[model samples]
Target: MNWRPGCDLAVLHLRARLMRALRAFMDQRNILEVETPLLIRAANYDLNVQNILCQDESTDPRPLALHSSPELFMKRLLAAGTGPIWQLCKVFRKGEQGSYHNPEFTMLEWYRPGMDVQG
Candidate 1:
C-alpha cells in the first residue's frame, strides 16, 4: 500500500504528541514558541546545506533563499532579549530525495539562554 496518504495522519499524531510534550517541557522552564521568516537574502553557507532556490516577484537574480535554519535570526532575537524560543518550520535544501529525506523538510529547533547544546 502507498504510504503517502497515511503520512498526514501520522504527522498529526506525532506532531501532537511531540508538541504537547515539548510545550509542557518548555512551559515548565519558561520558554516561548516563536515564528521566523521563511525567506532570506542569504542562507547559511554551511557546506553541509545545499540550498533549494526560489525567485521573487521582482525577478531578482539573487532570489531569496529558503531558510536553511532559523538559528541565525533566532540568535539575533536572543541577543535582543527574547527569552527561550522554539520553532517548527519547513526548510529547504537541494539534492536530497528519499523515503526518509526530502528536498525540503520540517525542522524543530529551540534555544534556551544559559544552556548549551549539551543541555
Candidate 2:
C-alpha cells in the first residue's frame, strides 16, 4: 500500500527556525546551548507518546533501547553540572504512520533547571 509522506525534515527545519527565536530569547537572558543524547535507557511512561522499543542487536541490552526523549537523562545532567538545556532530535514511535504521522519523527525538548514546566 502506498502512503502519504510527511516532510519530517521540513518539520525539523521549521522547528529549528522557530527555536531560533526562543534561542534569542534565552541568549538575551544569558542561557547557554547544550546537547543531550538521542538514545538512552529510561523514559517516562506518559500519555502523549507511544514508544517503539529498540534493542542493540550486537550489544545484548548493553545500551538497551532508543530513547523516547532525553528528559530523564537531561534532568540528571541538570542535577550534575549543566543548567537550562535544550535538545532537538529524531525519535521513534511504536504504532503510528501517516502524513501527520511517522513511525519515527523529530522532537524538541528543553528544560529549565530552576523553573517548572509552567515557565
Candidate 3:
C-alpha cells in the first residue's frame, strides 16, 4: 500500500499563495474575516443537500448536523450589526464524493449587507 498525502509540496505552496492573495484582496476591500460554528443543531432543508450528522455527547446526545455553508450564520451576524464579513472554512456534506466533489472540503462564504449582485 502506498502511504502518501493527497497534496504535494508544490500544490501546498500554490494553495498558500492563493490564500494569501485572497486575504490581501479582502483586506483591500475592507471585508472582515469571521468564523462560524461548523457543528450545528439545525440542518439545511434542501432535498439535494445531504448533511453529515454527528453525535453531540454534551447536549441532548442526539445527532448534530454539520454545516454545509456559513451562509445562515453569517446572515445572523449581519443582522447583529457585524457589517460585511467573509469566511474561509471547511464544510461537510454527505454523498458528494467524486473527482470535483468531496464529503468534506474548504468553502469560502462571503456576505455583504447592502450589496446586490450588480454592486
Q: Which candidate has the top score in lDDT?
A: 3
Model 2: CA > 4 A from native: 1-19, 43-50, 61-63, 116-118
In angstroms, the error of model 2 at 68 is 1.3
Candidate 2 local distance difference test against the native: 0.70
Which structure is stronger by lDDT: 1 or 3? 3
TM-score for model 2? 0.62
Number of clashing pairs per prediction, in order:
0, 0, 0
Give the 10-residue window scoring lowest on summed lDDT in candidate 2. Answer: 61-70
- Which stretches in model 1 have alpha-carbon errors above 4 Å? 1-11, 59-61
Sorted on lDDT, best first, the list reads: 3, 1, 2
C-alpha root-mean-square deviation, candidate 1: 3.0
Candidate 1 residue-wise lDDT, 4-117, digit = tens: 674677788998999789788878888888889888887566689877777876767777888788888888899999988988789887788888888878888998888888
Q: Whole-model lDDT for model 3 versus the true structure?
A: 0.89
Q: Which ten residues in a row have the lowest lDDT in candidate 3?
A: 40-49
TM-score of 3: 0.90
Q: How big is the positional error of residue 62 in model 1, measured in Å on the Cα after superposition?
A: 3.7
Q: What's the TM-score of each model vs. the native?
A: 0.78, 0.62, 0.90
- Compared with the true structure, what per-residue lDDT tens digits does model 2 show for residues 13-117? 897888788788877766656676666566545668766666786766544456666677677888887766777677776677887887777777777767776
